[model samples]
Target: METKELLKKVKEIELKTRGLTKQVFSGEYHSAFKGRGMTFSEVKNYQFGDDVRSIDWNVTARFNEPFVKVFEEERELSVFLVLDISGSNNFGTRLKSKKELMLEVAAVLAFSAVANNDKIGAIFTTDQVEKYIPPKKGRSHALMILRELILFKPKHTRTQLDIGLKFFRNIVKKRSICFVISDFYDENDFYDALKIANRKHDMVALRLYDPAEKELPNLGLIKMFDAEQGVVKWVNTGSKKVRDNYTEQYEESQQKLHDIFRRSGVDYASLSTEGKYLMELNKLFLTRSR
Candidate 1:
């Protein structure tokens, strides 16, 4: 993308996301992810209802009046947007492709994090670590992340969920809210890595999928290609058996993904490319808040 066009896109995304964050998501987001813990913020005159244990004896002695230590939740957070830029993400049968939805989803979360005064970072992967933008707190930094998510070209075309998660675990030592945005299309079972990453970070799975991915229509003869694997095959989609098998396979994968997340004690939700991502995300946020 050209410099001018990229800036325009960044600004456009920023306006929409920032407004939404300020309007709707900020509070939900704040309540959803918790802070590290409470920290002493300041000292104030003691109040009648104040906790007796919170009395600041030194401040009281210095001021010759009762003072109390004030504390607030250390609400700042490091939010990691782990995104998949694999070729398979390019497939969608709706108004927006999986990749497009992924970008928008990342942008919303980025803005929400910024609204809460959190540092946000991004990791773009496609079978390997394509890019890692370290966490930074600022509107400009968030916009830069949105820019990269829009235009980043991956070095590889395959999807390796485990490799990306392992890389994230190694780089981000502190606990963070990690949003793994992918279709969960990897062939390899990444349960071990998922568990390890979850232990280190508050990992959540945002599974993006296209309706077509789950079921095949009765289009007689079709040539299908695996964008990630670079494999091509002809399929008789008109055959009921073939369609049934395809649907079953996709469902099986979905169930397995859900099971893995459940077993690993990770929070996860699914969003279809044809569906409203914001609605699904809002539901997840509310669910987490409760």
Candidate 2:
């Protein structure tokens, strides 16, 4: 992409997503993810209705007056966009590719985090970690993330969400709100890693997919290629047995993903490239609110 074109795309996305954040997601984002914890702000003279447990005994003794330590929730949070950039993301049969949708989703979340005055960062990965943008707060930082998402080219060609989770756990010390945006077609066992990561941080899964991934069109004959592994095969799409087997496999994958998410206790949402992402996001937000 040309520099001028990329700039326009970034500006366009920033305007759209930032506006949505202000209009719909401002309060929901704040409520959905909490801060690290409460921290002491100051000590004030005790008030009648103040919690007795908050009393500052040392301060009270020094001043010979009852004082209470006031603590406030740390409003600033660090949000990590752990994105997958594998070749399978290129196979969307909709308005855009899964890769395109992933970028937009990440951009919206990044803008929302920045709108809430939180630091936003990202990690672009395939089977391995490709890039890491350190957490920072500002429109410039968010734009940088958008630019990276639009132009990033990964050296690897496969998906391993497990590696992404490990990288997140190792680098980030303080608890963060991590969003793993991917199609999640990996065979690697990431359940343990995801469970551990969720224990330490607030982890949410944003699964990007296409409706065709679940159902196949009955074209008489079709040639398919593995996007990541680069293998090609011709299939008799009209055959009932073949269609049934494909449908069974797709259903199993969906069920396993749901079970993994449920067992991990991580909040999750899915975005289909053929569907309205805004509606999906709004539904997820409303569901979370409930």
Candidate 3:
């Protein structure tokens, strides 16, 4: 994209996403993902309703009065967006491509983090880690991330999700809320890495999909392209057996993905490219808040 066009696109996304954050996601996000823990704020005179155990004995002795250490919830967080920019994500049969949907969803998340006064960062990956933007706060930083998401071009076309997860684990030492945005279309096993990452940082998987992936239309014989493999093959989509097998494979993959998330104790939501992503995201946030 040209510079002027790219800047315009970034501004548009920022406006839309920032509006959504202010109107919808800000409060829900705050409730869903809390800060690291409570931190000591200051010492105040103990009140009648105050917890008796919270009274600081040293302060009480020095001041000759009961004083309790006041603590506040640390509301700052480092949020990481682990985005998949593999070749398969570029295909969509509906209104927008999977990559486009992913970018919008990620923008919403970035704005939500900004609204909550948290630092936002991203990891762009194909088969390998393409780029890493360290966490930073403010609207400008979020817009910078949006620009990068719009313009980044990966070197590889394959999907090795484990590489991205491991790279995130190695670089991000501080505990963070990591959102893995992808179609989960990899052939490799990333369960162990995902589980380990979840143990240290709160992980949420946002799986993107399109309608065509779940069901194939009977368009007679058609050429199908494997984006990751960079290969094309002719397939008879008119065959009932072929269509049934395709549906079965998709269902099996979905089941396996759900199983992995469940076993890893990670919260996840599937958003269809043709469906209302806001509803799915709201549902996930409500579930997490509870």
Best by the TM-score measure: 3
The weakest ten consecutive residues by lDDT in model 3 span: 17-26
The residue-by-residue lDDT of candidate 2 on 178-200, one tens digit each, is 99998999988899999999999
Tell me, by lDDT, which candidate is best.
Answer: 3
**lDDT (Cα, 0-100) at 238 in candidate 1:** 97
**lDDT (C-alpha, whole model) for all candidates:** 0.89, 0.89, 0.93
Model 3 bad stretches (over 4 Å): 42-70
Better of 1 and 3 by lDDT: 3
**Model 2 stretches astray by more than 4 angstroms:** 42-69
CA lDDT for candidate 3: 0.93
TM-score of 2: 0.91
lDDT of 1 at 36: 59
RMSD of 1: 3.4
Q: Candidate 3, residues 1-290: lDDT per residue as tens digits?
A: 99999999888888887787777775799999998779999999999999998999999999899999998988899999999999999999898999989988999999899888899999999889999999999989998998998988899999998999999999999889999999999899999999999999999999999988898899999999999999999999999999999999999999999999999999999998995898899999989898
What are the clashing pairs of model 1?
Answer: none
| lDDT (Cα, 0-100) at 191 in candidate 3 | 97
Cα lDDT, model 2, residue 83: 92
